[model samples]
Each structure stands twice: as C-alpha cells, then as structure tokens.
Target: MSLAQPLAELLEAADRPLEDARAMPPGVYTNPEFLSHEIETIFSKEWICVGRSSRLAKTGDYLTYDLAGQPVVVLRGKDGQLRAFSNVCLHRMSTLVEGCGNKRVLVCPYHAWTYDLDGRLRGAPFMTQTTGFCKENYALPPIRCEEWLGWIYITLDKDRPGVAAALGPLEKLIAPYEMENYVECFRETHVWDTNWKVLAENFMESYHLPVCHAATVGGHSRLEEMECPPGLEAFNYHWITKEASLPMGNAHPDNRRLEGRWRKTTALITLYPSHLITLTPGYFWYLSLHPKGTGQVSIVFGGGLSPEFMADPRAEEYVATLKGLLDEVNAEDRGCTEKVFRGLSADAARAGHLSYLERPIHDFMRYIAERTGGYRRAFAVAAE
Candidate 1:
C-alpha cells in the first residue's frame, strides 16, 4: 500500500524511541481521509468485539449493529449455536432486523423475505420467474463470527484471523480472572463526539486520571504503583496496581486466592484496534468502540461482576453503587476526550511528550500505523 505523506510521517514518529516519542500527530485523530483509510483497512479486517454471549442467552435471541459500513447480526440459533450474517436481505438488500430481541425469524420489512435465527432463508414470495434460482442457493452471506471467553466478535474480512488466534497467549494471562463466566450486568450505548482513538487511548493510560478524573476514580490512583510492561503480539496492557477503593474495597474474600498484585490491582487492557477491558479482582468492564466517522465514535460502555462479587450477600446493593460510580467515571472520560478531540484539530495543537505511563498509547499508535499500511517496521523487537 502506498502511504500518504502525512500518515507516513506519523508512522515514522511512532517508530521512534519510547523516550522521544510524542503523542500521535493531530491529523492522525481528526483527518477524515485517514479515517476512511482506517475503515477500509483496519475496521474491515479486525475481529471487533460487539457484545457478550450473555446478551443472547436464549434460543432466537439476537442483536444487530453496523461494522465499518456493513450491518451485521449475531443470533443464537435453534440448535444453540451463535452465528453472524450480513443483516441485509437477499431480495432488495433492506436491513433484516433492528435493535435486539428474541424472535422466531428475521423478517425483512421491505418485501417479507424471512430468515431463520441462524440466517438461513426461510421465505421468499413469488420469485419463480427468475431463471435457475434455488432458495437453498441464496442464504444470507455469513460474516466471520467467533466467541472468546463469552464475548462475541465479528469480522468483515474473511481472510483475517479469528479472535482466539489473534489474541493467542493473552487469554492465559487473563485466565486467572475466569473472565468467561462473568456476566454482562449492565450496558449503555451512546455516540461520543470524538474520534475512536481519542476514547481508546484515553482509556488505555492513567496519565490523565489524576487530573481529568480527579473528582472520580483518580483520587485513589497512585502513579508509582503503575506498570506498562511491553505489549504482546495481539494487544497491550498496563497494571494499575493501586489499593482497591470501591465501597466493597475492590478485594473480594473469595478472590483472595489470587496471587500477588492481581489479587488487589486492576488490569486495564486495549486489545488492538479497540476492545478495552478493565479487570479488577471483583469486577470487569469494557468499552467496545466503533467509529461512526473520523469525528465521532459509537461506544458500548458497560461492565460486569466476577462470580466472587455476585456471591456476596450485599451483591444487590453494591451493584447500584458500582453502576453510579461507573456512570460518573464515564462522564469524566467524555469531558476529557471530547475536549482533546477539539484540541487535536487546532492550529496551535501539537503532539506532546509522553510519560512512561503512557506506553500503551505508544503501542496503540504502532498498531494504527501497521494496520493502516502506513509502515512495515516492527514495534519493539516483535512480541514473541
């Protein structure tokens, strides 16, 4: 792929030494042209997380969302399998479903073309006039889908690796948390008036927590306790090993079995393109970011409790408190990221020096550069 001059330069800057590396250039965040390139190369190819298996626990339960520019539907079939398909009908290409709910079949509102929950065509009205057409030959095209640790992910690019293959050893690192059994207790979707990278990078590091989130979660943040070990082949993560400060004190009696730092700290991870998960001993939360365009992002912001947390007698009451704190934390994040988006496009705005704590952002930039075909250089001697 031929690189744009500005994008090429941004990649070059990203490839520099960590101490000298600045935040990515302003154009990387706000340029519509670059965003288009990302949509085609990165969004279209990555196995993006949409939601969790808990979202569709019963047969016929389904959900629909747009990825890149394509509408996708993932549903639980009658056979107890989860599948993904192009949500457009085979007839005139109208959307097959909207929002999310359990149903017997996916019926196209345009002309009554109906499909089974697994995306098999079940009904098509009066189409015998066409030559050599068979109902079996025209099922909705399957979109690549896979579930990893209870999360459902889909990719538009058939050639890309499945989520498990892409994530590789990171799964073992998180295995101690038993994240697969966790529940999707709550979720809120909204459009943030900021670039997807803005929210993703913001969520990746704690550098701004002391300042932007001071009134919220930042009060407990101790920069000295943080660690950003080198990233992996598929992702980057940092340890926010501060003492737990939740009403439940972040430590669960049942979770005491966990060894060392993990028993008391949170693992904040950015799984490539965009799957952000914050894993604490008691709970886990995620930000599934989908870019609406260069200037906007659609976020599925939500969290869940570990089995340990759910087993507590005060579980019900603590849920409400947890949700409220998350809500406030989300607001603080919104304020900071939106303002940063506005700053990125300013004439005087320039990339600034990065703290050692912002190592994940540096890793994230290398991901952007590689995925967008901006550069072929390696990121830190390759993770393996």
Candidate 2:
C-alpha cells in the first residue's frame, strides 16, 4: 500500500537493460479493470491539455470537447477572460453544445437554460417560482483551467494542485519554445478501434519507427538517427533532425531551407492523464483521448501556431508539410493499434510485457499506478 514501494517495484520490474526495448506490458492495454481504474485515477486527477488558448481568443468564442468522459466547454467571456465549465446543463444534464463556435451565451437545447461565458447561470425559464430552485446556485460547474505556452489545460478535480505544479519540472523544460505565439491551423478527429493507451504508448518511444512507420516517419527520420532523451523529462522530449524531408502535400515553403534551420519537434507531454501535446518545426498539435468504453476510444487532434507564424508565407508551407507528415504517421499507428486491439479482445487471459526502450511507458504506468493504488491492486482483483 505504500506509494514508494510500489513505484520502486514497478521501476524494477518494468525497467529493461536495453534502451530500445523498454515498454509497459501488453496486458495493460487490453485489461478492462486497469483501464477503468485509469479513468478514475489518471483522467480525473491529471491536468489535461483541452485545447489551444487561441481557440478562445475572442470574447464569446468557445470550443466544446469531451474531457475524459465529461463534456466540457472552453470559452472566453464578454470580459475577455477564459474559463472551462461542464458542458452539461445543470437542469436536465443535456449537453449544452455539440461543437465549437461563437456564441454570445450558451443555451441548452433541451430547455433553453442559459449560461454566461464564465459559467454563471444567466437565466432559467420558469424556475423562479419552483421550490428549492435557486438560480444563483444553478450555474454550470467550473473546471480548473490554466494557460501555458498557448495551450489550455483543464483539471476535473477542483482540489488538485495548480497546472504549473502538476507539470513539475516540465514547465522550465519547454520554456524556450515561446509556444504562445502560434495560431491554430488544423483540427481533426480519428476514432480508433483500440484502447486509448495503445495509441499513446506508440508515441512514447521511437523503436517502432523502422518497422511500423517506414514509409512516412521512418523514411524521413531514420531509426538510427532518432534521439530518445532521458528521464520523465524525456517523455515531453523534442529533437531536431537536420534536412529531414517533409511529407508530400504537407511541405513547408522553407522545406528546402530546413536543411540547416533547427526545426523544433516534441513527443508526448502528458497534459496529465489522457491529453498529449506534440510540437513539430512548423506547428504544435494536441491530442485528447476519451475512452468510449473498455474497447473503443475517441481521439481528437488540434493544431495551431502563432499569428506571426501563420502570417509568414513560408511558415504556411511549413504547417502544410507538418500536417502531411502527421497524417502518414497517424495512419500507420492507427493500423497497428487497431490490430492490437483486435488481438487482445480475442484473448482474455494473455499478458503483455514491457521493453527497456519504453521508459516513457514505465513513467506513465508508474504515475497511473501510484494514483490508482499500485499495480498489485489493479491486477490482482482482475486476475483472480
């Protein structure tokens, strides 16, 4: 039950001698009980990147998304302030909005209950005469929201530490990028037939580049040339590869010039729990993984860069190039993850193991395990 002991055991058990082979057990991906625990411990407690700050740049701008399983609306109020609120209407639990757009106020389709950008209940039709009806106390529940480097992060748990504290040492690590200047360029959603964790683990390491993504990622950045930085800081790691060829259709205008310029790129920085942030040379993208059930997952991808970058003609081309590369990489990953999901579903008792190169998976699993009462508790009941 001691936190340190389980963490130490997980470190010892999951750690591998080979740098390239480290990974979490395959069982973790396929296990239902473990996945449920993650929803409670990891998703609920973590500070997840919900969207970009620019998404709510103007007053009355809002974006509705499913954070974990809870529907949430990220909005900028009339006062030019940003905040997050449970997207569900307090009256009937109906979702306030289905998507993102400019709205002076959020109006529930079920009964026209209205809420301001700051989540204050602005009006409730006919509720004034009802007993126990207090309009003042009927506001949409607020989620803890913070902006860092242009990314908007939300925590479902109100009592949790501030976003900076949850990010720990990572705050200083990404300080050099000045990420806030970027504007959003692309947004897409890809629903996978696999567990969310399976897709995420794919991003945590570079070992699969040679075999899994040879056509797109592998051809551009060779496995031997790819760098994997050390420690948990490395999980949010970024590396610059010189003269890397941009994928077709997504080429930057400066594609020819990238031969020498230091292009920035980053891997999974768990915006706590199921959200992930990745930065490439031209733009930054965020991935939010929402578990639909034990077997299905919804993945939302949002991309952006500074207004200055978007204004630059060359940067426009760069953004295009990055998108092409992402499409290919994601295509390859989706295929593999779907197959893994099918394989695991076909076998209920199978157990999977981790490799040393997958230290990020270990870090992620350990983080989850600590929050969920250790691996023994997670696995024991299910295995029995």
Write candidate 1's Cα lDDT for 1-384 as tens digits: 233765976877778878888888888877778888889888888889988899999998988889998999999989999999999998889998888889899899999988887677887888788777677877889998899998899999888877888776788777777888877788778899999999999999998988998887787878898989878767999888766658553657777447876677788888988999998878888999999987899998778788877888988877777888889989999999999999887889988889899989988888888878556645454442
Q: Highest lDDT among the candidates is held by which one?
A: 1
TM-score, each model?
Answer: 0.94, 0.81
lDDT of 2 by residue, 39-78 (tens): 7777877777766777677998888778667988889988
On the 0 to 100 scale, the lDDT of residue 219 in model 1 is 76
What are the Cα lDDT values of the candidates?
A: 0.84, 0.65
Off by over 4 Å in 1: 1-3, 126-133, 377-384
Backbone collision tally, model 2: 22
The CA-based lDDT of model 2 is what? 0.65
